[model samples]
Target chain A: MKREIPLFLTAVIGAIVLAGFFVPHPYVSVPADYLQRCAVIVVAFGYALGGANLVQVNLEGILRRHPDWPYKLVLLAGMGVTLVFGLFVDRAKFQDPGTVSLWIYDHVYVPMNSTMFALLALFIASAAFRAFRVRSAEAALLAVSALVVMIGRVPLGDAVMAGVFDHPGLPEWMRHLRLEPLQQWIMDWPQNAAKRAILIGAAMGVMATGLRVILGIERSYLGGSD
Target chain B: MTISTDFGVWIAALLTLCVFSFLYKDNPLYKFAEHLFVGVSAGYYIALNYWTVVDQYLVIPLRAAFDGSQAGGPFQAQMQDYRGWLIVPAVLGVLLFTRLFTRLSWMSRWSLAVVMGVFAGLKTTGFAQGDLVAQVQASLVPLWIPGDLWGSLNAILFTVGLVTSLLFFFYSREHKGVLGGVSRVGVWFLMISFGAGYGYTVMSRISLLIGRFQFLLVDWLHVR
Candidate 1:
């Protein structure tokens, strides 16, 4: 009875949600809209679940006195501090630019994210040196394009080449024909195609998962016993 | 000689040096930067969620709705109507937290199911119109261009690439003869596309590193 009822509701609701796209009637549209609102609330709940899970695991680790326990302690501290400030801390006193929260985000958070991303430049340079060999026709084409882009971007490429070749020469033509056309081709075709595929897959996945949840085929998420 | 200019230059130089260190090998300095990243990101997301909920949902709307508190407030009446709806979501959000208590965890599914249904409906419409239909339509372009031979060539090549790629993605069909040949070509195209994407990502990373270097050298230090 427990499973059947949920599954029946799932088939009914899921079908209606799917049909709502085609149907313009208030019956479908109105319920669908309410369902949408309900989804947002549910997703918000999901986030809470995720947050609580993080806290629970870390807290448990700390309590057990496990290795790297101090880091877990720090994680708990950060989570607790943030939550307390969010829920209980007086909002009025920190009204301006110099609030503790704002200051932490700007200086601590932003810089830290920036620095990690910055570290990837090293990996790129290494990858370029090792992987950019012209082994085939396609590889040769890619290598030439990469060289053109790099030369066009940097001043050293122009200065060094201008001395050997024609002045104001290779970089300008490279920029006009190769770099521009390649970039345009990438943006117009491949990117759009990939994005479309992802959208389709994601939409289908959402429908399947929604049906699973509605019909009670996905009772595991609800803690299973019921 | 000056403090601000000197500081900028020093910081920029340090960042540049740190980035350059990657050329040699990974070290503690890299790990330090990485850990700081993890810590700060976790902190930032929590702060961001608070800001979004408090400002958009609770604070601004509540003030506008209930408080007849602002003069020249045309939105006051509408806000009041909207305020009532907030309770539904608020209650659901609270119920979501019920997962923390094992006893009441079952109630969380009600909220979850509603959300899944709505999101599914939204996705169905958006994907059909924007992705499935639109992508197919885009591929069905006029092959011949009036003036430019190159334009016509590009159009033909694009159509070929698009169709082959789609066929490659279809896993249900057995790859025995013609389909195999088409899919093999599609595989090559997909690889090249991914290589291009990787190249772009590398450039983005480099640009970010350069920015940090610039900040460390120009903003934090006195050196020119």
Candidate 2:
């Protein structure tokens, strides 16, 4: 019953919601809506479960004197401080400016988030030199496309083009030689088509997967137990 | 000549520097900031979820239902009626914690099953309606525009790209001769898409990096 019950629950719930889309009756719609709400509540519990697991894992690591235990200690301390400020305080204080939560958010989280993403710029440049090498026609196309986009979409590209080529002495085509229009054409036609094709294929894939799950054929989510 | 007087600015500046120090090498400062980030993020989200979902959806509805303390006039009757049904989900939500115990872990599957089922069902119809149908519908543009050569060419190119790209994903049939060539064109289009995407990403990230530098120099150091 342990396994059967949940599997039955899956099939039943999935059928109800899927039916609601076609049937549009209150019996299906109402139950589907209720199931969705339950899912939200359940998901919130899942988040709390995740947070607890993180705390537990970190605590265990520190207890065992694992590698970077001090960092783990610092991690727990940050969580504790943030939680105390977020949860133990009054609602007004928690949400208001100058609060400890807000202070940490502003000073710590914002800076870290910004800097972390900003570091990606450096990493991407390093990666481009490594990954964007041209050894074949395909590779060359990719590299050229990237270069065109990099130059076309940015201000620096305009300045470089205008400085070097944008002269009255140059031929009309050469004078009007701009990366932006070429980039735009590439984006509007092929890029957009690729995106739409992927979307359509993925939608079909999702439907198939959903059906598989509802049929209980995809039991990967259930784990190996019973 | 002047450093900022605000302690928050000092903290933000130092943290930003600590993160930037990563460009040199992964060091203690970056590790510290990274760990702190994960922990603080968890706590922040947990608290936010408590306020937004748990409190708003489950707790408040259940609390008011039990306590009989809702301001009632027109919508009160409907509000009070459905509030009682929330107990079912509240019980299910509690079931998710059973996984923390080995013996009780299997029970958590009950809650997970519901979550999986609802999402799968919703997404099945959602993707079909929102993505597949919508995209295919939008792709059906006029291929031959009179007196608009470029427009016609663009439309035709779009149709060919879309068809060929979809064919590239068709694995049931062997790709040979004509199919092989078409799929090869699809591959090129996909490569262009990826290249453009990467280029766009690099530029945005660089812009953000510039913003960080401006903050350090112009905002903090007064040296800009």
Candidate 3:
């Protein structure tokens, strides 16, 4: 009864949402909108539950006296402080200057996030060095396009070109051989085409997966225990 | 270098240093930052979700269903409207909290079902319209433009590239003969796309990296 009811509910919700999309009548849309709103709230409940799960797992680690339990304790303390400020202290949620929650978000979260992504720059350059070695025809093509894109995107490419070749003396066709235009052409033509094809493929995939999910065939979200 | 004296700036700088230490090796400071990041983000997510969606969508409306006004009493919505008929979902949402209890965790599946169904329905039609139809429509350009040689060549190349790329992903049959050749061309286009995309992404990251360094130098320390 437990699993069956869920499957039935899924099918009904799926049907109604799709119907709302196709039908466009108020009778369909009103209920559909309401259902979606309810879904959002329910999903929020799910999110809160996810947080509880995180806390639970960490608390258990602490209780078991795991080797790195102190880190878990720090994590809990951080969450507790942040939650108190966010949930109760700043319940109004306006970006008031006095809100400690906002301050933490700006000072702690945003900079940490920025620094994390900034760290990726080093890794990406290392990857490019290994990838751009150009061992095969396809790889060579990729390397050339990437090199062109990287160079064209910055002022360095144009500066180098201006230093090496005088634009005034260059012929009309030769002037068009600038890396900027060349990269733009590659992006507008081949890249656009590739993106379109990839999106089409992805859309087909989404359609299939969505349908499967709707029909409850994909039950992986329902854990194995029950 | 003149150092930042503001406590918040000092905290941010120290955390940034802790995070950046990963370039050398993972240590206690890095682990501490990583755990704190996870915990804080998760906590924020929970609080934000609860306060924003569940309260706005569930609690207020449920209140309106009884008292004919939202939680704060400023906004007045008629309780009898179809929108107020969220009782079933409210019940389901409460059931989701049952996940915390070992014996009643199975009840959470019902809420999960509703969430999945609606999202799946939304994404299916959304992708159909935005991705498939739009791209296909855009690809229907004039294959042969008169008088303009490059335009005509570009149009032809775009059409061929798109067609071959689609064919390359078609794994329904064996890749041999004409299909194989077309697929091979598709591989070239895909490779170019990937390379260009990576190159573009790396440059953007570098710009961000530069921004962080600028912050560290100019904001945290009065050095350039």
Best by TM-score: 2
- Of the candidates shown, which would achieve the greatest lDDT relative to the real structure? 2
Greater-DockQ candidate between 1 and 3: 3
Better of 1 and 3 by TM-score: 3
For each candidate, what TM-score against the reference?
A: 0.73, 0.94, 0.92
Best by DockQ: 2
Q: TM-score, chain B only, every model?
A: 0.75, 0.91, 0.88
Which regions of candidate 2 are displaced past 4 Å?
A: A90-93, A169-176, B69-81
Model 1: per-residue Cα lDDT over B117-178, one tens digit each = 55555665676676667766766778799998867877776666666666777789897699
Rate residue A156 of model 1 by lDDT.
Answer: 63
User: Could you tell which candidate, 2 or 3, scores higher by lDDT?
Assistant: 2
Q: What is residue A90's positional error in candidate 3, in angstroms?
A: 1.2
Clash totals in order: 19, 0, 0
Clashing pairs in 2: none
Alpha-carbon shift of residue B176 in model 1 (angstroms): 2.4
TM-score of 3: 0.92
Best-to-worst order by TM-score is 2, 3, 1
Error of 3 at A160 (Å): 1.5
Candidate 2's residue-wise lDDT over A6-107, tens digit each? 999999999998997898667667778878888988898887888888888999999999999999998989888888888877463665776888888888
Candidate 3 residue-wise lDDT, B44-84, digit = tens: 78777877777777777667557745453433323224345
By lDDT, rank the candidates, best first.
2, 3, 1
Off by over 4 Å in 1: A1-28, A81-96, A124-226, B1-40, B58-86, B101-106
**What is the DockQ of the complex in model 1?**
0.29
